[model samples]
Target chain A: MNTPNTSPSPEVTRTYRRLIPNTWWLKQRSTILFMIREWSSVFVALYAICLLGQLWALSEGPERYNALLAKSLSGGSLLLHLVMGAFVLYHMVTWFKISGRIFGSGPLSPGAVTAVNYVVWIAASIGVFYWIF
Target chain B: MCLIKFIKSLEPLWWSLFGLGGAIAAFLFPAHILIQGVLIPAGILPKDMLQYENFAGLLSSPIVRIYFLALIVFPLYHAAHRIRMTLEDLRIGWLNAILPLLCYGGATTISIAAVVVILRLS
Candidate 1:
């Protein structure tokens, strides 16, 4: 075996790593949308908290729960939840779209997987609404 | 052996939660949101849908409690995982060591609190 060189070697290439801007995601449309999709988790978690708040109010007895209901029925709360709902929808849509690929390409095609997801989503929605009404 | 060990790691556990939560949220949140946030508030559906006794009765069911808990908690872990990844991508890695603890720990706390509140609903 050749002995390892102990002295400093001339003009050895250092490991090359290019620095990326933190804002690089902002620069590309696809990247921006990707970031939004990921960041949408913030809204999902926030909305889950909102739902938990509803549950908490329920456990607190009727008066508090009705008061919370009254607040929710307001136009401002309506508008806010509408915006929140949009984020959740975006998150779901992007998720379902990509779920096709993550699910693997066995018997079902990717488009078929996506279609099945949407079908199930709509059926679940209808089933819940029916149960509620 | 290495692959199995990796699969058994906390990463996969967290990732599985993320995927499961994403699937549940995608399938469920839309209809719930539409009815609760839009249709009801828009006066299309009556506010009685959320009236205390009715909702309380709904929550009193053990299965319903568990369903709602899964709905709320899984997505929390899902969100936690995504938030951690997103923050790292945004070059916020200085807190690398604490990031998982913060994210997963917060989810765990909320989950416990959710379980407590939900179990007491009856």
Candidate 2:
């Protein structure tokens, strides 16, 4: 079969192997964003680990829990939390954006699915903030 | 490779956890991080937000405990799934063999620890 490859032997067929680099996601803006969205889950898990530690300390006693709180309120922790919060925010947005497709065209449109997710997310955030602060 | 194949066959289980965890992360994590991380730490909110007595009371409530458990547990699996897949994407040779066990196993271990902690909270 004739093809558009400017080759001396166009009739020859070969396998197509996807040779991608470790940093292949870096090649494009969308891929970079996609990788970041996927990769930031590590930090998300770290924060959960930290939360677990806090609970463990709480189970231990008030003294230990308060001490942990003191550390959590430090400048370093504030910085780390800021970073973690941003990553989680990104995770939320990306996940919800993709969440709409879960409905397909069955009943709710993709935009409706995404909108409902965002609405619920905002309500949950507000409820949490009210409970805490 | 029997063990590896067995784990590979459990992809749907891992994927289901990932979606559940993703939903939890989206709805809850940012708010907790914003309050516990940003507000209290920066002194924008009163310190009692994390006062041990208040927090302990919160933990005593079964609802809060369940919420905390969900918060502390599921996102871990979500993260583990992502991490394992990312390692696979990197095309590392030996890593492909161990990544699933290492990542999901780590998540399972931590989740168990969290449950123990919550169960023992007084």
Candidate 3:
């Protein structure tokens, strides 16, 4: 059975989308940094995995652990670490700076928040150094 | 009773881990990276500083074990969440149904592995 078509059509058809260009995120400086920050977590995860690998090596014995550490000290590993370090550091600083916005906006100043964040971080670093040394 | 609804309900949980992980990454990851990456390679720090025995001795403390747990686990979730979102942003929306499970599931598995390694170290 066929029924008569009942759908109404506008005289002029309109599509609603405002197409986002592939480069939309790259158009802004802040967004460029934002994408970098977002992408840096992969390196952080890689670092974590490296640490886990070291833990497994340590479990196997000092010989295996030392071998792993030596590999970590190799030129290739050092360069990889340096690249990852730069990315992760960028991630951390940007993350700290934007934390105020994450919690809420228009209450506490971001400057004050950033200052506090750095201060505590410095203190923690000092404590770690004291413990390690 | 679809997977999307299931994932939506867990949003808060993953987001909380994301926040915590971000903070911990700020705290420890950079310093370790600098030490292991630049300073040691540049010879500013002694190689013996990270020797297996010395590092093991450092990890022997229970408190340090907990810190290690935080360092390893939190960042897994953070990376998972970020990567999943980035994939979505890249127009892989059709995969959305399985993305959450794949991302968060991978993180959970790694987190468990990290916990097991930490316990062994302790």
lDDT tens readout by residue for model 3, B1-112: 3765787689999999998888888877877778777788778888887888788898888988888788889998999999888877766646866888888889989999
User: All candidates' TM-scores?
Assistant: 0.90, 0.89, 0.87
Tally clashing residue pairs in candidate 2.
Answer: 0
Q: Once model 1 is optimally superposed onto the true structure by TM-score, how far is the C-alpha of residue A96 displaced, in angstroms?
A: 1.4
- Model 3 TM-score on a 0 to 1 scale: 0.87
Off by over 4 Å in 3: A1-23, A102-107, B1-4
Provide the lDDT at A58 for model 3. 78
Candidate 1: TM of chain A? 0.85
Give a tens-digit lDDT track for model 1, residues A9-66.
5555566668987898988899999999998898888878888889998888999999
The segments of candidate 1 whose C-alpha lies over 4 angstroms from its true place after superposition are: A1-4, A7-16, A104-107, B1-9
Ordering by DockQ: 2, 1, 3
lDDT by residue (A1-133, candidate 2, tens digit) is 7677767654455657788778887899998898899888988898899899999999999888878888998999999998998899899888988888777477889999999988998999999887744
Supply the TM-score of chain A against the true chain A for every candidate structure.
0.85, 0.79, 0.77
Using lDDT as the measure, name the better of candidate 2 and candidate 3: 2
> Compared with the true structure, what per-residue lDDT tens digits does model 2 show for residues B3-101?
768888999999999989988988999989988889888888899868888888888888888889999889999999999998888888878998888
lDDT of each: 0.84, 0.88, 0.82
- Model 1 residue A123 CA deviation (Å) reads 0.6
